[model samples]
Target chain A: MNISDFQTRFGFEAMYDGYVDAEVLGGYTSDLLSDVMSKAGEASTLVTIQAHKNTVAVATLVGINSIIICNSRPVSAEMIESAKAEGIALFRTDKTQFEVSGLLYCALRDAKA
Target chain B: MDIPINTEGGSRVILELIYSLKVRDVMTRKLVTASADTGMREVQQLMRDNGITGIPIVERTRLLGIVSIGDLLKALDQGQMAEPAASHMSASVVTLEEEMPLTFAISYLNRYEFRRFPVLDKTGSLAGIITASDIIKTLLVEMNREVERLEATIAHPQTIDPAASPGLDPGSAGTPEEIVLSLSFPTRQYDFDGAGKASAEFKKALKQLGIEASIVRRAAIASYELELNQVIHSTGGVMEYILRGGRITIVARDQGPGIADVQAALTEGFSTANNWIRSLGFGAGLGLPNAKRSGDDFSIDSAPGRGTTVCVTLNYAAGP
Candidate 1:
């Protein structure tokens, strides 16, 4: 998906000055800890609502491009800076984890279709 | 008439020249360090507070093993009720000597999948520690610094647009025509593993120079897309940067199953990637378009079964 589509669908404004020119290669949405571990890489953008430092570390290890910190719980300042220094874009949504995952599923399904 | 093959642009010449680019030149010379005896609680807290996943366990310039947030997580799994750090920390250290070049550092770091490596002094003590993040910082600085100097020259008419009219600061404002900033990386056939290293390193060079945020993002996104293409499609390829006037140009060429339709391939949603590639989070067909959009000028040359080459030039106007 294009950056504009993401902005409209997710209702998010760029946190930094210049907007992120990201391409959705595909979408991976899951809360299952192990599931994420077995999949995901530095290239793939991850969608999750789990608000914990562990999530950041996991994303870093697998080299995820971006982490959609879902649930609108307000991303931690530390996580934000970590993502910045690492050049991994972090996106947060007011939508619950389940709702966001559903959206992601639909998005991916449409793309594949 | 015979077309003369010259060494002016030979691959061997390029590789030999780039091989000399050292790690300390690209590695974060001033890395964050910590004492080996740091407590587990403090270490974990530090990692969280600093937004860093790893820290170099050092002692007055002595290198010890490194600890990552993952290590701490494993420790937590074992037991998290106020345990001693000695129980959790791994002393099997991987290190790089301060004199060691950045090229060697990149190889070792990529092989070990290490986020940070402690730099040893002449005595094998921790002189400092470098992390993957440090590399990112350095690359970004290179791009940022270049843009700023360009912008500065624009702002001050007499300053001589650094790239076009230099002789002001060779180290910073040197003539762009003479400044050749290049980056190299290992490539494999459809090997998704460690593919982002080149782009990451390229971005680090930009970031380290303290380049403007806008230019950094431009070069980073463009470089990243090119790097991903190399890993996903090409047998291997290299990314090179050249500066002239106020334009910074990037060239990405790779040997692989070349595209049959360059224009169609440039579309937003035309992908020929497989399921495995898709699962890894790429192959959606946005790489080409994304690269095009990120830069002011873009071009692509390819053949059905030969290879593909992409070139992008970003023009920065002098800041008034």
Candidate 2:
């Protein structure tokens, strides 16, 4: 599904501008940068409470189609610059990482599984 | 590069070379010495023959004083050429440790008008001497190599980073087929603000290079895990990435207080992550296990006080 679909289904703010329509094949969630780096699969939508600039870089590096900054964390200006530079689809939500990850998992379960 | 004076960390290469350089690396180890009782005429002849300005006056292994050309001139003018070297030598001295870093020596040189620094060994005996000219000579050689490297980089613009090719075989690749990406990022413990920046930039660059999305994801995820692991478990560390032909390998090396057990740490849930870390959603012991699982091959070599090095290799050619 497109990030717009995910945004529409859950009230999430699209935070950065980059031409990204990457397909979401799966989803992974973690607040620890290490865990997410190791476990997050390809084309996955990464949902996490990490809203720092490094988050955008990780999302771009891991090929995460979209980044969901959970817990309403503030996305800094540096993060937005990296998001735009990396062509990553950026989003933010008031939900927890667990809740957002669950939603994305459920959304892709039938299609990916 | 001309680094802005206000910039933090300064120019990386300048700082790296300056700090990495040691006094032992540049100090003149072949020292010429004289006994305090040596005849003034003999010492003057030794200095004239060697073209040296001064000779350190010694008593066995202990440094007593220094006799310079001026001391010799004074002795000759006063008709004291028959006197011992100590009679005209300056007794006070400033010295530098043989093991001192070049930076400290540089600071000492700047703070004093001393023509040279007497280097002492661990036994407090004179080992060598360093002059300002020695440092300039060392810097000239270093700066020349840098210039050559920059020229080579300018000669070929397609390589990722010219400095990145330090370890590459001169004949490794003449074409783009074997073109690889080599980079390293330093990470600090408890530096949450900078935690994932390295992997993120790595991921973006890989994607731009046209690596398949799935492959980039796996490699990036693994990179992130290693970076975070350094921040959480070790002292300060660096995440090294080498993207070679179809394979991505990351080596996580750190300064330690290293791991006592590699096996126990790899267990699915046996984490040393403190309670505070747990609340932040890490230290679950899943970081290493997950990193290993993501790699086509993974191995960790670690020892106490020696630090840890975790190598993760992901072959993009292999199915994800």
Candidate 3:
């Protein structure tokens, strides 16, 4: 399923309130930039809370589908602005990291089914 | 809670505090090396004797390439096993420098689907070689060290200032889960041959941040599936993550046609994916469901004309 389908099915509120017309890739969750760089392949979705620009550089290098900040944490304005500038779909979640990952896994499974 | 302690600690005491650690701290410095001219029979014997799967093929200490058991066997397929090692060895060797941080090394190994790699010097000389087994050993050693340090700390909890502790320092033997970190990235759809790049990036990030192997694998699989989903289902999308408080979460969003039926899509055998998707070794209808099974929690929201969003969470439970 696509990002819009995820929002509607899981009742996720858009972080930026803007229309993002991207397709759903896959998910990655790790804080290690080297690992992300070498492993997170191109055009795949990533799930990470590391908001550094280095993250953006790696994402740009590997070319992810979007980014999701979990753990009920808030994305810095600078990060959000940068994401927009880079044309990345930035999001935030009130759910705990566990909750967000679990929900996404289920949805992806549901879609696969 | 103060107590007297000795320099040496008990194993149980150490193991209790060192569980769930990573392999970045104790990677072997003694990297094995070999020559490209080495015969396949000799290489096979060396591997069997040393219990190794790979070796860096060097020329006058310069890293020319590498040879693995698989490479040797592949040569055998063409009746070339009797030939020189250079003729059968992999030409484009993936390598790492000795000075590179362990995180980078781990990421390189995990991301490339390679079981072993050569380490090179500035002059292109072979320094050593690292393998998946070596990394695993490193992790084990680090865990042991952490356990020892933790036992010492616990034995004299009052003498050490908790506030002054270097949280999650691998060299200092701190707990693995003590680190607080965050990461982000963008997804692009440049071409078909370039697909799976985003997920690869995400895996690299995790390796750099020092996540465990199992965790990285789960994340990689999920990301790869989503990337293939993008190539098969839509024009493109993005995937991102966050790591904190003993859990990692993954999110994928895209501007593609939404799923028609959430229930039908969630099933195992059903697939709207085309034959092209299957041709690429995906679209077996296992991507989404496999991701859900691998994660602690999974959720998705999509509309018929709107885009799609996916979220996945991985919880590294405390006190495991």
Candidate 4:
């Protein structure tokens, strides 16, 4: 599934759409940036409530192509700017991190099938 | 002359200098002395001729007492100008060892009413004398030198070429490659907005250098964790990145209320961050451990009063 698919399929609001629309192979759910940095897979969509610039930085470092800011956590303009600069797709949702993670898991599994 | 510097709360450089410098470093070695039989009138002459406020009464380098200008004045007023130096000289004196740290001298100056202290060598011989003025002068000179060094570093930032670096054998590399990148960024305390800037810059530079993606990820993780540690834990500090010899070295140095227990700090799930800091999706106690896990080599040096310095080295050849 491509990064744009997360916005269209799951109805996640795209905060920054300047990214490359790369393939999202999987997903990792965590609020802790360090945990995400160490464990998140390559080209994964990060499902977390951490809507900040540091989150974008961590995603860039760990090869996370897209971030889904769950729980409607307020995404700062700086975060959107950073995401745009780093070419990482940013999205927001009213769903919690667990709900987003579950939905991403089902969607990724069905896409792989 | 009471030195107005607060020994406990002074800047890290000053505090480190004070603690590192010995009493002998700041003491006046040129001695002017009077014997027990030296007349009070002669003491007065010595004080006038040499422009000295005090003179130690010594016998073959053994310190006995000191005669000050005040004692000479008392002798002149009481018709005792002809009396021996020992009779009026203050016998009980507080002395400092030549090897004692400069902080001892500073504390002694604050504790004692005397203007100077006689510095003694290991053999119990009078080596020198230290006054407040001497300490002040030395510290000022050293601080000036330190400032100049910092300015020079700022003027010409280091971008080291691996070929020119000494002690690195060129034959060790499979192919002669020129690796050049050294950068430093200053990090402030609680500056969450600017916390990961250094790591982002490091990632960009590493990517530009054509380093392997997995290795770059490790380096980025290590630098980010260490950077965030400084922002959350230290007063402020600098994060330095050096890429040379097929290796990336990240150093985080801080002016600190240093870690009291470094072993516990390295353990996962041990954080000293406040509640609000934890609310920002940090303070998970995984910072140091994650940094350690990412790097090929890790070392941390810290103490309660001294600042903390953490160095992480990642080899480009090392697998993720």
Candidate 2 vs candidate 4: the DockQ winner is: 4
For model 3, residues B1-320, the per-residue Cα lDDT tens digits are 11112112345333222222222233455656667677777777777888778766767777777788888788778777667778777889777655444444555665587776676554555666666666666656766787788798789886666633323223634545444444444343322334555666677777776777677767766666666565457545666666667777777777767888977777765677543233333455666776677688899898778877787888764334
Give the alpha carbon lDDT tens digit for every residue of A19-56 in model 4: 68888899999988878988999999999988888898
- Top candidate on lDDT is 4
* TM-score-best of 2 and 3: 2
* Per-model i-RMS: 9.5, 3.2, 11.5, 1.0
Which stretch of 10 consecutive residues in model 2 chain B shows the poorest summed lDDT? B1-10
lDDT tens digits, residue span B74-178, model 1:
877877626655556678877776554444455566567666777666556566666666655654665466668769878986744554331223464544364
Q: Which residues of candidate 1, in runs, are more than 4 Å off?
A: A1-113, B1-176, B317-320
CAPRI classification of candidate 1: incorrect
Query: What is the DockQ of the complex in model 3?
Result: 0.02
Measured against the true structure, the TM-scores of the candidates, in listed sequence, are 0.40, 0.51, 0.36, 0.59
Q: DockQ for every model, please.
A: 0.08, 0.30, 0.02, 0.52
What are the lDDT figures for the candidates, one per model?
0.62, 0.75, 0.61, 0.86
Model 3 residue A68 distance off true place after TM-score fit, in angstroms: 22
